[model samples]
Target: MIKDMQDLRKLAYNRQLVSNNRLVLPEQVSALESYRVLEKPIYELIIDDLKTTSWTVDELSRRYGIAKEDIREPLLIAMRDPVLVAEGFVPRRVGRAQRNGKGSNVQYTLLPIPIEARIFDITLGLSLLHFDTLLVQHVDQLQFIPHDEGLDAFREIVAEYWSIRGDKVDQFISKQDVNCVLSALGPLFIPNDGGIYDRIRNKLFEEEKLLVPRFTRKKINKDIKKIRRKFSEGFFDLTDVHSTVIALSDLTRFCKYSNRMSEHAELLKISEDFFYSLFIQVHETVPVPASDADALTNDISEVSIGAGQSGTRDKEGTTAMSWEAPKCPVDGTIAEFYTVITSETAKITEKQNALRCLRKHLHAPGVFDLAICSLTTSANTNIQKEAIKLLAQLGDERAVEPLINVYGRVGATLSVEVIHALGSIGSHEAVPFLLEVLDQKRFENRIAAIKALGQIRDPRAVPVLIRCLLEPKGEIQRCATIALGDIGDTVAGPALIKLLHNPRSVIRVEAIRALVKLKYTEAIPVLQQLLGGDRSKAVRDEAVRSLKSLSMV
Candidate 1:
């Protein structure tokens, strides 16, 4: 009776209403083939079952004696196939009541195939299913795959998936499933695919209340302990090591952002242990070979000769001891020290001693480079913090870019260290980025940015710091006062003077000290007034100190 696509769709819809599962006619099968429905035997079986009644994957698996995993792919394919969708095979989730104390299951039912603009949705859904399946199948072996290609493909799929599903992606792919995929992909080292993780995080944030509560602290702690045990036992897959670390990092970050860090103290400690173990396993440096050392010595001798230094050659054709080339800054002892610092078998005391030696020679030729590399590559927080401190002390503009990069990639605690380093380096290049950090809503980040900005003493930050002085938070205003003083800018003088009249003695005391640093002679009268009339002894003492400093100037 079908004359056209409309007639076929109508027939298909009408057929679903009847109880009897009549045989499909040859003409009907041929008509369905035009829509590409029966391309595979699984497709045929799925379609035949749908013709009788909507079924869950579990039901289809049981009826055909197939594994649930085997049934899921074909079911997803049918739901997303363009031709099948156009022929009206729309998938809808139907909830079944709980049975035998088991939770309800989501079942897929088909709608009359639409002949409209569902093609894009169909393509996007299929693409998601395809990549999801691929990643799941090759999760452990992803290190062998081309990271850029896989990352690009997955990113594109996520973009399209987000465009269609928006915040409701959780409905299509559960939060647990998303977490599983992220755990697999987030820790990758070579591809550096944080963009994919960021996108998923943004989508999840749209329904954060619904999703975040499900990630229980107990469950996360259990997962971390299991991964850590495998990692320490040397049974963990090499490919999975980074994955485990990154997954823990993500969980730690999640708890921090959700204000649940207090509830996950054990999880954080375990995560730090995992990071330290990963660092010890992977960050070992090979010493220069003997041949390379000889070559380096020869190169140094040649450079000395070029610079008009006399280099005598012995009978063995080596440089004579009477006129030797200058020694390398990183000598054998320093090199050995570096080796011990990164050694997996080294005792804690041995490692600490090696670290001290390296710190003492931090100004040596290779030490700065080593610290920079460690800052970027080491997941251990203490090492990373030490590197940040050393790089800041070096005050080299070269460290600016690397410090900024680390700020973006690390967690809140490490980010503060990076900001401090940037400020201590005092490079104008960090100004723009530091200004951006000042705009963030995170209280800790904002405070760190303020302090860093002051240390850099960039006048460009004066206006922003002035605005922060007006905020209601006493901690913010206090920090801003110290920064303005460190910056020693006269423009903040009026704001600083106004704070002298505030009720909080701490605010008045900070303002008095800031005025003195600014050398604002005009504040000398206000300082004199405070010295005589301030109620708090601390404020009066600061005022007296400010007056004496101003009078000297």
Candidate 2:
């Protein structure tokens, strides 16, 4: 509900929680402005709900008027970018594929897209779009497991979509579309197996495999009949029967739990049978590879294992077999380091090494926890700097006090990064250091500090910021002014108004901006004075622009 920039800034400075001020980071702000095409619309659609809860693929798809499949690709890409997620943007998966042995289908969760990555996605939209094209073009490269004539079904779809004669599957479909078909077809072959469904889904997306069931003719016919019934009822909405079969073949997932009623079972069976017929029809219509004889060989080698064989060992000390462990060919330590850094799926030893490396690299004290306390003293300058940088990445508040204590130990780069990191950490302890930095004479350090405070959006910064606004330096005054605007405090309105008549055009302009950000109706008199009576036309123009922005807000 922050209605304007001033309110945003004030909340950032006054809030007990610390957070990054994206407005201060030119790169972030610039990126956000550029990426507006992609993020603005998506954000408007999901922002409200994302603040409080996660959205399922189906729900978001329904609400946004997009295919669930289409929604996931961007959602996944956004989630991988933390800056976007921090801004109250997020995506979530809907249903679980029934479990078998492998895993569940890939589902995307919704989250905020941070300013940094948002820029990249927007700037590189076209190039990334081509990646989908390439994926479809090279679909043949992916491997698939043969199930329920799954392999055949996959080939049929690929040939129909990508073969020399058939229609090209150029239109970008979403992961959700495929997911829907898989969910509906679950009852026929496998009742509730998420794992099996995932494997099948992967094969389909990757254009590798199918999920054909191994059963008697009668059973197969029954399942086919059920699937067909669903298809006729517009379950899949396919124009060509072959496309429907290809979809069903990929949709086949394992069912672990059964529906209590035979009627449900019968319905699933019919859906499957219907799908089988459609799949074959599509297969016949498509231009199959010239040599159909090789179909048998395709099936035979589908399950072949890669080279590199055996070892036997177990804690029992029997003839225990040792299987090959998955290892990266690069530095083993790097792998360990990543495991530690990710903190998602790694062992304790890897994490320790990661922490050790981070501690060694603590030159710029920031937020990522590169500092280590050896129980002696805290001013271990080098270690502390790296620790602060790492802490910024970690975004943990626990590092705040220690960071404030280490503030004076580093140079400009480290200080700037640390200030921002502290903002990101959103800790109240940082306010003191931020205030101290604002008191410093140098513009760079002072500006960084002011910007950090603004990002934190803590109201406590208002008085200190108000004091800075009284200073004469245009740079400091401008930073403080913008910080005030971003902070969005009406309390600073009077101080900001005082700047409107200052001799410096820059200060006058910034003051106008601050007032607009604060959205102080009382400032209409001051802005009008500046716009009509100011000596500089540029200053007057700037004031008018601020008025326009405020009006829009």
Candidate 3:
């Protein structure tokens, strides 16, 4: 038996015939990684046979049906460093281990490999989202029945983006192509047949209804549930899922797939049952309301801020509730502060600075719409942005409705800022608008929406934020990880633990941090595993910190 290095050297090399060439160790095998071999069923059986308990060589042979010689190297592995063997093993170093026959009932225990291993992870290298995007386009391109302008415009949008990036439309997309799409989209795009797919369908439909003749909405809608379910099953053959459902896609489903969505019930938002997917349609024009001139002028007289000496102050407690001490760029008191912000001929910089000053100074709060209206309507882009920030800082529940109204009306940049402020304000009233922003395309905006939901830390948002983990973009996943932690709800515990197994170390680290903040006891075992088996020092240290925190709690 290979009890030591000398014994291993005496063993013959395992051989395989490859196209008339005898493939030898270190030649065909050196190109492979240790994790590759560990991910297979053979490793699973080996781990199950030897893990947590050691067995004599003769017993191992009886259990796994391996020859005595074959069991030698495995036995050597079980003794010296059983925990890491599943990651990869080299027969050269035997390390110090009890001899197979040194004692009766010699035992070996195998530790399971973490899915997020630095190497040898074959499972879902990238989120399924990456592959789904390409498949969606391929299916759309193959749709001959609806050769209308909407589909044409959608194709043009894809082609234009590829052309802009110098990527070719005809270029064959490889298995790795899915990851590229996810990177471009930001972290993850969770595919739920009910919400996202139907939204994609409507996005295509909306383009046809608004742009081309209303009569052009003549196409029949296909089964999104069937399409999504098939993709969920890892069906990559487009033809297999009934007309391109899985067509050339299904690399990895974003987030971990489960038999029961109930496990993550906390991640689902209210009214998301039939909501439209974010960023599905390829519409060129978003049709933002034509300038804010008319709306602002009509509301000025009715919208005076600081109308009352006893106006309500913001209820304090939440993170976004605190206000800075009032400052005056123009000079002395509240009156002067109000005058400069209200002045028409003031330089944009002065007005912006004045608004910034009033954000803290303007304490009177009944119907502050006049100030908010002035800022939102200001022709200068800088003034508008400053106004949005000031309104959010105003720290009143009333700001919710007005912000929600102007959500999509402003330009994209201002829209995202508004969304951020809504989250900062922390009100239930803002949830619907925030949910709307999440459902729309434009991941950058979606990210802002996510941060806002996290800031609010509302239980209603747990499920929605959980879904963000499935997005293909690692940064998005990182942000979601931070957000989940900020909420500090235990219901999200399992979802966060699942991320520890994600392939990306950065993401895995973020997940660990969030799990720590949540104080989830259930993660103890997983954290212990990472603490012992993780390859990266940073990850291992993070696991240690989390474990320490959990124990203290």
Q: Which candidate is the best by lDDT?
A: 1
- By TM-score, rank the candidates, best first: 3, 1, 2
C-alpha lDDT (0 to 100) for residue 228 of candidate 3: 41
Choose the strongest candidate by TM-score.
3
Report RMSD for candidate 1.
Answer: 26.6
* lDDT of the candidates, in the order given: 0.55, 0.45, 0.47
Clashes counted in candidate 2 amount to 102
Candidate 3 C-alpha lDDT tens digits along 298-363 = 222222222221222334211111122223333345556566666777644455555656666656
RMSD (CA, angstroms), candidate 2: 26.5
Using alpha carbons, what is the TM-score of model 3? 0.43
Superposed model 1: Cα runs more than 4 Å off: 1-330, 341-353
Tens digits of per-residue lDDT, candidate 1, 1-553, equal 3365544443333222111223233245433443322222455678767655668877876676556776787687775444443343434444453544666544566544221112122221112112333344444533232333233323334344234332343233322222211221121112223334344233212232323543676876776676555443332122233234434444555566688756456555664444333222222232334443332223221212222124456564643211122333446647776665556676433442344456567566766665665565556554566677778788888777666645643444456778788888889888888777776655556777788888889899999999998998776898899999999989999999999988777899999989988999999887877654564557877888888888999
In candidate 3 the C-alpha lDDT for residue 484 amounts to: 88
- Candidate 2: Cα lDDT at 277: 33
Summed backbone clashes in each candidate are 4, 102, 30
Worst 10 residues of 3 by lDDT: 246-255
